[model samples]
Target: MSRRIRVPFVLLLLVVAAVAPVGGAAATGSSDAGTVDVAGTADLDGTADADVTPDTAAGIATNHGGTIVRTTTFSLTPGEPGSVDATMRFDLPDGVPELTVGPFPDGVTVVDEGGFDREGDRYVRRDHGRAALTLRFDLPSEQLSTADVGIDTGDWAYVRVPYVPTEWSYYGDAPAFRGDAAVDGEGAVQGEWAYLGATETTTRSAGDLTVRYVRAAGDPDAPSPDAVFAGWNWLATRLGSGGRDRVTVFALPTPDAMEWRRSPGLASDEDGAAYVFSRAPATGTEPAWFHEFVHLLQGPEPSEGMEWYPEASATYYARLAALNLGASEYGTFREASTVEEPRNVRFTRRSSWRSPTDYRQGALALGAIDATVGAASDGDRRLADAHRRLRDDDRLTYDSFRDAAVAAGNGSAGAEADRVVDAPARHEFVDDGLAYADHAPDRDLDGDGLDLATEREHGTNPFLADTDGDGLDDPAELDRGSDPLAATRDADGNDDGEGSADEPDPKTVDSDGDGLSDVRERELGTDRKRADTDHDGLADGEEVEGVTDPLDPDTDGDDLGDGEERESGTDPLAEDTDGDGLPDGHEVHVGTDPADPDTDGDGVPDGEQHREESESDGEDVPTWSPRGVGEMVGDLVEDALELPRMVADVVRLLT
Candidate 1:
């Protein structure tokens, strides 16, 4: 079975904090409920809203460099095996309008808000003054098994500490957590983070990047830390990003019962760290790593309004980077980007974290933007330039990103982006940029005269000389008034009217019912529609089967019918088969042996005899020689007399 689990940060927090019941619901015991309490003092000086400059527009905040020190503890009582108790304690800045905390994890029931009221998932603090607040909730312990937070399994405790952001701002640094964390009254010490689910923690440095791998004790099949570092370095180089100072990757065992958190999984934090869980070892070439690395390179989310860009960019670049690194092929990325998904909703309006369709649509839109940029700039710019600009920009928003793209590309690229990204419906764009990046437009794969780009433009197969598998090549078909798209045609070059039924393919079969197949006709340079290409007296089948030329009516040019020559047992190619002065046809008409040069044992040749007879009569008397005339006269005399003795004597004399 295969499962895909998307554990978005905001969603995870909501699930964690909202499990407590509102009123009078019995508190499920700690065993059944997984309780996590997070306490942190507000660093008001580092608030993103306070850090915003005058030039920043309303509702926009600046980056907050200061960190909040948070301590989150999970406690579960022994009574209920699956329940949990969760409490969140944090201080709000003085003069702030309101303090909001969660969109917490599900299965969390909010039982108490410490005098604060609930507005959506957050505990509303309307006092607008400096104060400490605590919100309590109950959640199912099973949820902890999937959550990146530490899990306590009685004998061992495992936890993934992620920087959970408060709901009030988008630009604050990830809160720092205490190294010494506890679960169920047992103290837990920080262990090195694993790389790709290895049993031991291994660290390696390459260039400016440092990578850490953490694995459980028994699993020894995880990838080596050095290998992981090398892979990361390769990716970084290809992506054109300087290496980060530190990147921690956790390789955890594949959760058995949690189908929601199966292998082939990757989730990253605001800090340059990731938790990758899979049934198999992690490789840098995997799409999971490529995707997460894209996130790392993108840094943190810059603004709430631009929530969709990071994931979208990550999804799009994962495939692109894979292609560049030779980890994937063009067809793979093309297929992924061009998949048909429902486009009823705008890509930006769709939830980036929860919906896969939004990612796909956004990737497709980015592909279109990239192609447009590359085309308009003549290779001067691409989608990566926009991403680089976005990474460097302090105030990031959709408009800012769009402007960056426009600056990198031309006006047409901006228009393309608007058409694909800002439109109400998602549109799929061609991946020609990726497909033909390394080739010229005129490169022909099948050696058909038409280039690949032209073939694509004309809706013909670039890999095939004849796209429809017709007897004619694509260029020939185009030149000779044939439809390259249709394989079947009638005698007049119209569709064969077979509709959906199985009919003979014109490319493979002789549609005109001619003796020659279509391929043979093409090879012979004969008319496929007409059996006798030269309009000869003989049928094409007879001419071909009899070793005669179908393109020429008289192959021998002997003034004799080829068929007649065959009947007379004479060579059709020879004018006179017997080397006689008379032609084979003339000899046959004259009732002389064509193979014999002389007849009646006469010293003169048959041709001489025929010529003498013709000259004597001043006409063409080929069979009227003196001997033949005397024999004919004697036969007439015998018949007239009807006298047996005289007829016998004349016949003997004539013989």
Candidate 2:
């Protein structure tokens, strides 16, 4: 397919750069539910009349941070095999106003303060006062025992925690010591603490999960799978963040897929596969992958707002990794090159076969920002340093990362922060005059074009061609042993053809992964690499809707292909197509086939060929043109010469 021209993020980036924020801030506020159910004490004196805004939760009292405080548990009561109450405690700041609380998620009812929101979710009573609010939502153990909660300050920050399904510890004490009876001959405590007791400590550990690549659907084979073990071990080790505690990975069969997650953002399943359809997955080795791993490790509290920063970090670092790996050289076609911008752009846009332009353009914009903005100081924008800091200090946030990036640029964090806050744009450094060809060596070493100033102003690359401006120099791709004409086909792939390359080669056949080569798909009109023709979700020989398969009876086996059914006019997948008692083809050959059932067994379908005959008309039919028949056979008559002399004389007269 022709590449789509990137609609130019330069404008968006530069505009964003002018007003980017100084620091990342969270929206504020929390909701309220009255009293501690277990204690039967009203934390709030009463409902105070006050308007609630996202900025702050009213009537809640807190002891510590000016924001709403939250805590988490590994398991709780509702999660128990047969419990009903799933509860969480919200410690509000002392001077907050009236606030309302509720049972989140669809279909839950709040028994105490009954009211429904526009979306039909339930909300409970409001509390006003100077103490902690203990809100409990009834959850049947049959449903999910655990649910996540968010304590939004409704202003600058929202605290979140996972509410497990078991009773929690209020005393903040260590687990009780267990008696150790079993001892070796040397007399040491044999079984130290068999089970972990109740506590609310966040453990930094590797996720416990496994994944495997299968050949196709219905293939029963498991081998060479990826598994996670040990506390944040290899993942952190690979990220170069030693001693890191937490890490998460959202694994999928491929990075450019759309169907994995229905929506954008991070999702952690029961088995710990954190599926993130929004962010682009890392492609390079070592440090680059580690850079992505860090983002997962951070588990940046999910918010629709803070999505951009993490992605910016990942893209920035990936470029750095490429630089470090000696894979990129900086210059021009014929000089040195640091980035394969076109490939980077192509892969980013087309990845997942969905949302092609948004991600790649966004990533490119960020890379440009890092390079140009970071260039003010002699390599100070220290993008790599920022990533290192993030991995080293797990608590580092978007604001902190931005600060590091600014420091590298020899700029004030406050100034850049304001820029970010005002405009969410990024800028790129480019010398537009020179055109770059596919696989062409970089030419401009000093980022200055010897070409015309107009070309430089336009940042135009003369070498870029093709009508739609897909950014590929069609002639160039063809020169480098690739098909320049077709959008899909290209050479350079494996025999199995299971994985598609960032670029596909077409000259050779066999794309379908079916042992057959491209020559076959061309002959059969099937995708050269894939054997399925007509795209009816089945291979050609297997089934064609209008065609039949002789080998398989029931022509269309309910479970068979159309080709199988088409061998005869009936659907192979179905027992019969016409609904006749007899099979289809039998009607054509079986003198009395049920396909055209008629009790009379007549040649016509009974009534169509009625037994009536036209009555003989009384009028005589005129017969003429004896001469026409005679003229036609006069030559034969002459050859036979059986006619008398008078006949011969008549024939001669006519001739």
Candidate 3:
């Protein structure tokens, strides 16, 4: 029902709101008095007093020259059976500012509300709207909001404060989304991110960089926050700098209901913060955690044509970071280079970019530019420096990238950049201070099954190694026809098996389990989402297992599907299993055994048994001519007279 996700993650709608300031400056430490206590505050009745000194920790906290606001708190409680009771509280310091709200997500409606009227798709706020307005919305497990990651499974609730549309809640001259979003009992929401139970927290740090990991307690098979922190550490070290001193990682267990292909994970690059949706383990998108970390160090969206740059850098550097951390191999990296896009596709036309289809293209091109810049500076300058320069550049474009490269002392990179920005052409790419060498193209350096020849075919770096801590190496995976990149899943749905994925089909881990990816099905002219490409009563996996053509309804051209032929005791390849004149399909249609020559038990073969009737083996009887019928009748009468005469002669002889 949903489209396949080419890139590993979805860069969700980046919230662009006008500056609705709630607090003045940043503060350190926590104050219990103002700690956003929404669940149990019988003293304050229903309203959260805004005049009280803002809880600098949860509401609006200032730190490291940045602002973290939590002026808007959305409290969620377990509801009746498969439902969740949710309430939104906005701390409007200047009273309820002129605002219009409503038309909440499906399955969410307010009861006993009298001040608002519906107009088209929105609820018009009336004059009598109170300061402590409590809009009770029911979030059922069966139905979910469009942009919100709110879930209620009758047992626990994971709620990511829904990003309401600007028009849906038009706050005229009022600070609508002024402060940060926090759960009542869960404390401050990270990047308006996941909140489950009470938001238990932990920390992992390297040097000056610290990653705060959060998740619900007792979540099943939650992803290891330590592993994600390790990924961030590697990327930070490789880049020689971390974007910010501290960031948050909400590690929610991957919900069985959550579809990774539709929406995998998200990151707020401005805050150096991202969340790992796989607190529970998953596959399809290999190294999703690391990729999110890379995004933390990136800047906002660039201008047109260069819009692809942010994604390209993230995709490219993330894989490389995984390799640096011993998570991936050179063969895996090289294989991505081999991925081909349309010839007309170029980095300069990034405005027309699509996920994953163009990501690999830009990645390879960016790699070439990085190599060029690295070579020009004789290892003194690298793309990392240029990247740091661009992180703060408000206006990001190709020219700015060139200027950044020049300032980094790789002036020669502009020429190579020209080649990549336009079209991908052959260019000298330096890796580790030397041009990529294919002295032994057939050599499998790491014995991971992939050879140097395959690596260099993409015209990019062949220097790669599987560093990810999985037992199966890249060479072995490729040699065995298993997925060489991304997390591999075993038959038990665990993440430690050799994969046969078609680039991690976005729908599910081999949704059809047909060993083919969804996109590959499209390219092969098969049903993109159906496991049975030809719908011959056989699954694509079954077809593969039985050594039949999954793409053909009738592999043997017998007008019977391979599955049907098997059921009908006929040979799919022979057109007929038995040595009969009738085809298997025709014999079945005529109710005769295709395996038997004489299906009617006559002295003649089934095919020749009805020879006088018709030339075809159809369900029809031959019609006798009128003269032939009369001749038959006369012979029958003469035989009857002779029988009586013979009987009388026999009786006289016996007497």
Model 3, residue 542: distance off in Å is 55
* C-alpha lDDT score of every prediction, in listed order: 0.50, 0.30, 0.51
Number of clashes recorded per candidate? 43, 103, 26
Best by TM-score: 3
Task: Kindly report the root-mean-square deviation of model 1 from the true structure over all alpha carbons.
Answer: 33.7
Better TM-score candidate (2, 3): 3
For candidate 3, report its TM-score: 0.50
lDDT for model 2:
0.30
Q: After TM-score superposition, what is the CA distance of residue 498 in candidate 1 from its true location, in Å?
A: 28
Candidate 1 lDDT over 1-655, as tens digits, reads 1011122222111112232121111111000011112211122222121222222336343333332323344454345444434444444332223345555554445566764677776665554333333322333333333343434332223443332334432222222222222244532223221121114677776335666656555645455555445546655543444224666665545445545333344444333555554344333223665576566666424453455666677677766655544455445656667766545444443331235654677677777778666655655457776776665565467777678779878775676666666655546546343222423466675567987567644445555566666566778666655555547665655453323332344456563456666566656655454565544456566677777787655577666667676666777777787786888767766677666777544556678877665343343334745666786896577456646744675674333
Which candidate should be chosen as best, given lDDT against the real structure?
3
lDDT of 2 by residue, 518-592 (tens): 444445433332355333344544443335432222344343344434444444544434454544434333322
What's the candidate order when arranged by decreasing lDDT?
Answer: 3, 1, 2
Best first by TM-score, ranked: 3, 1, 2
Give Cα distance to truth, residue 441, candidate 1, Å.
16
User: Which is the better candidate, 2 or 3, if ranked by lDDT?
Assistant: 3
- On lDDT, the stronger of 1 and 2 is 1
